[model samples]
Target: MKADFLLIGQGLAGTILSYRLFRAGYTVHLIDDAHPSASSRVAAGLYNPVTGRKMIKTWMADILFAEIEPFYQEMEGFLNQKLLHPQGIFRPFISFEEQNEWLAKSADDQFEGFIKEVFTGPQFPGVNDGMGGLLLKKAGYVDIPVLLQAYRTWAKSQGLMTEAVFSRNQLKRGKDGDWEYQDLTAGGLIFTNGIRAKDQGFFDWLPFAPVKGEILTLRQDFYSSKIINRGVFRIDLGNGLGKVGATYDNRNIDLEPTAAARQEILDKLRQLIPEKVLEILHHQVGVRPATPDRRPILGKHPSEENVYLFGGLGAKGVSLAPYFSRKMVDFLHSGEEPQKEVNINRFFKYI
Candidate 1:
């Protein structure tokens, strides 16, 4: 059986790319084991225009969000679900330097596109230590677990998805520069295995520093319709439940969520709304596929043209993934050029 592409893994990277490929009239065969460590499953899937203490806007937020907005909208409509949220994030500023840096960046012309001067008074009492901060417009959350489930079901129904974990032993390189796996042959193969990318054979040459994240679900008042917090993220998950995340650890791979991380999250949440009633609903941990350079490793394997990869979005996978997936598909389909910053060619010399 001939296929345009054989996509490995059904995480955000694989799902988004395969979905777009199908929409673009390509025949794709997807396979996955649905590992719980998949980042998309545990991700809060929030998109903040500006991230980190540097107070800089996320790399290419306007362009990425613009292209991705309609893509997710179409997915939601197809699934008959609301998968994307346009709710803005109001970050709590804890230090004077934090507020000052935000103000400095807000003054730049680049930031004007995404950030609106946050003039609103504190909606959450005791939030930000009375330090007002910036509001990034048109940024919000994606219900990643919901989207993943919906996409998986759709792909399964279409006979485009398989339940097996794609094995390297099953792959055979053709003499003509292509790949064959069992009864299926493809012009190219893409590995979107999330944190598991480190375990892949040919593509493992790229640097991947994995990070572990732990998130806790907490109960808010059922009447609380607002998504406000200075902590990691605050959202209206409905039925008095809101999810707060994510503690970062570089060394641990234990998927078991810990009480220590839960306590840290709760403490941070309290700084924003001190007197609020809450309950710990659940906690979960997942591994993030972080690269040494913090940019995604995209491109073909050094010795093979058919083997390619799209991993290492770190914590920004929810926001940056859709755009990069589309880029990878285009590059594979039409020989379109990828931005030098993200292409794996930069690391080829070292590898």
Candidate 2:
């Protein structure tokens, strides 16, 4: 078979990149065995404008937020499913000092686009927000697994998705500068295989600090339509169901859900709300592809031609993937480069 591009992994990176390439009139084939522990499959998929305990604006939030909604809205049309949940996020102040800090930010013109309101009164029932909280707009979550499945169905119907394990042994460079992978030949190849990219021969030199995360789904009687985030977050899933958690553990980088992690989430959840946990519906574990710089790595390989990588999104994959995917597509199509921060050349000296 012949195609314009060959992509590895069907995770968020691959799914978004393939969609962009397909829309750009390029025929791309994606290969994935669909690992059950892939981060995209278990991600909470929340995209927030403000992040971290400091509550600073996320990197490139202005530019990234502009592209996120429209991108997912288009994906909703293509997938024929409601995947984008546009409900805003609520972050409660942790202390009186934090509350005063937020009150100061309420008037700051820099936060005008994202801050919906700063409430000093009670925000929700069965809640513990005596310190008040900040309502942030243009922030929400995506149903990643649903979107991934939809992409799979669509890609399979288009004959652009292949379910197979990708091995470097199956890859060869043709004399004409095309990549020959098994029975398929392509003008270029991209690896979007998340942490597995560290194992690839070409990208092994890239700095990857993989971290394990644990999350939980619970059945509760709370009736909030917005996301509540403190140290941990609780996203209202409707129907007496809510999703809570995500504990980061860089030391124990494994895919097993431990009771310790569960207790950690519960501890954090207790600090935010007064609601009692009715039951634990589900527990999930996935490894995030984190980098030391905490920015995504995008661009072609240093030594090889027409070979590229798009990953290291960490916990912010939902926020970063869509925007970077377009950059990757533009680079592939016209050699347009992404910003210096996310461009892979930032770490070229290490490699």
Q: Count the backbone clashes (under 3 Å) in each candidate.
A: 0, 0
Q: How accurate is candidate 2 locally (lDDT)?
A: 0.90
The parts of candidate 1 lying over 4 Å away from their true place are 95-107, 125-129, 174-177, 222-231
User: Per-residue lDDT for 245-336 in model 2, tens only?
Assistant: 89988898888899999999999888887778899999999999999989999999998998999999999998998889999888988899
Clashing pairs in 1: none
Clashes by residue pair, model 2: none
Give the top-scoring candidate (TM-score): 2
Residues 1-351, candidate 1, lDDT per residue (tens digit)? 788888899988888888878888989989899998887788888877777756566788778878667878988988888898877677666667777777777778887768755543455544554766566776778899999999899889988888997788888988777898988889888888876765767765676788889887777663333345455566768886778778889877768888788888888777665647567777888888888878886777778777788878888887778888888878877878689989978888767
